[model samples]
Target: MPIGKLYGIGVGPGDPELLTVKAARLIDETDIIFAPQSKSGKPSVALNIVQDYVDKRDIPCEIYQPLFPMTEDKEELQRSWDEATDVLYEKLEQGKSAVFVTLGDPTVFSTFSYISSRLQNKGVEVELVPGITSFTACAARAGVQLTEQDDIMVVVPQVSEKLTKILPYVDTVVAMKTSRHLDVLEDCINQDPRQKDIVSVQNCTMDDENIVHGFVDNKKYFSTSIIKFRK
Candidate 1:
């Protein structure tokens, strides 16, 4: 049996055309394609983004839908992840090259982290294909500069309290994973009195992309906000 390998491929944001050249090439060459969905029997946004580049002509595809349990059930989440890992392990054991598609860069807040960590522990050969992050996409769409000469930029995810303490010192801040914590984040930013240059970009690089500058009351499900201190 040929040795199987795992490829952690990032599909970038929602745009299919934004896929990295390497990522697109690997999708066409990999023997099998795997994408994880939030729930069972659901379509994967990551797969959908790169469907055009992926040569599904005769490749077998596996949709591993791990339960995205929102509750704080650590045990249940681990169980689901383990079961999902088993499915991947089965494919890997067959000596077939499997591509695990993830949104954004695989190394940054991507689900591939957990799977890759476990696979590495088991001595599975793995390769990573990095893609563009939503933060850069949002910045481009909003026409904002993330950094200037000798300036520091911090990328955070919905940790408003921690950000509240650090925002005063940073020149640029990009906040992600901001659906439920939108209100709190807004409150924290507004309280600083230097948040006049705040801008929010939601569903970046997609058709329904929304960009709001200054103050916004109603927040969407998936969004990112850039807080720039120009004072």
Candidate 2:
């Protein structure tokens, strides 16, 4: 039998409507769906974005939400990856294809990156299906262009002192996962004169979506912020 292939599907940011047509079609055709879950019973944010579509699908598929232990320990993370690989390998070896849903573009700071590399090392074919990114959705909600002519765009997964270090060279800084360092990011933006506009958006396309045209005092874990250095 031919070996089964794997797809790292990006489900887009929190909105079912934002899911790409190809991703939807593949979800219907795939034998199983793997979504990341932080807790045992809780549904994944990525899965939630496409749940409605999954429910309406004519093709039946098994959905597995694997729990990813939250810890900074490298050994723990590796063990988690190994465990995830074992599960995926089981399906692939049986000639069954699986789609792993990710919150944004699978190539961009996704947890699937680690497992995808491992699976590739084990000789499984891997495909990445692109979807609308959170930053793109946030930018649209905030009505700001990521870049203009002669401008540069920089994207960081989280806020840190490194963002301050790069503030002098980049024209725009899009910081995702801002809930961890909102105050620090605000200070960095304040330090740069070129950073003329700052916008923060939470839950970009969902019902509880929030838009802050300027500096924000309230921070949500689901938020992403954009810093525009020029007009």
Candidate 3:
């Protein structure tokens, strides 16, 4: 039996066409595909991105729906991950090649990192393919440069409370996961000394995408706010 291998494939932002040739090929060729589901039992965005390439007739598909409203409880998170890994481990033990699809880039703020790490520590063969990130997609959709001249760019998750201090130094700031902190973010950027213009993009590169400028209402989730200081 061939030693089972794991593929951490990035399906890009939202557009199915944004799938890399390698990603598309893997989805087509891999014997098994694993997609993570957020609670509510909905299909994962990651899976949706590469659904067209997947041959439902020939391959075994596993939908591992994660417990909804991911909590800060370490014990609970660990328990859930262990259970999820068991499912993958069973496939690997059978020498089944399994591919886990992730949205945007696999490396940036992806839960795949934790899963891959646990698998590798147990001696599973693993490979990663890069995908388009929300920052780049949002920036392009907004038609703004991430950085220019001698200015620096900072990418931060919306969880950080340090946005106040960081605002003074960077030329551009991309704040991800802004849904939880939308109010704080709006107040911070609007009050910046540079008076940075803001662009908020949700589900970038996908149909039904939402983009807005200036003093946005605090409802949209899965968003990135771009603050451009280069006037």
Best by TM-score: 2
What TM-score would every model get versus the actual structure? 0.91, 0.94, 0.90
Taking the tens digit of each residue's C-alpha lDDT, what string does model 1 give over 47-89?
7897776545456455454554444588877776777677888
TM-score ranking from best candidate downward? 2, 1, 3
Q: Which runs in model 3 stand beyond 4 Å of their true positions? A: 56-69
lDDT of 3 by residue, 137-183 (tens): 88888787888878888888873567778778778888887877777
Worst 10-residue lDDT window, candidate 1: 62-71
What does candidate 2's lDDT look like per residue over 187-212, in tens digits?
77787876378888988898999898
Overall local distance difference test of candidate 2: 0.86
lDDT of each: 0.78, 0.86, 0.79
Decide which is better by lDDT, 2 or 3.
2
Q: Where does candidate 3 have its weakest 10-residue lDDT segment?
A: 60-69
lDDT at 19 for candidate 1?
90
Which segments of model 1 are wrong by more than 4 Å? 55-71, 215-219
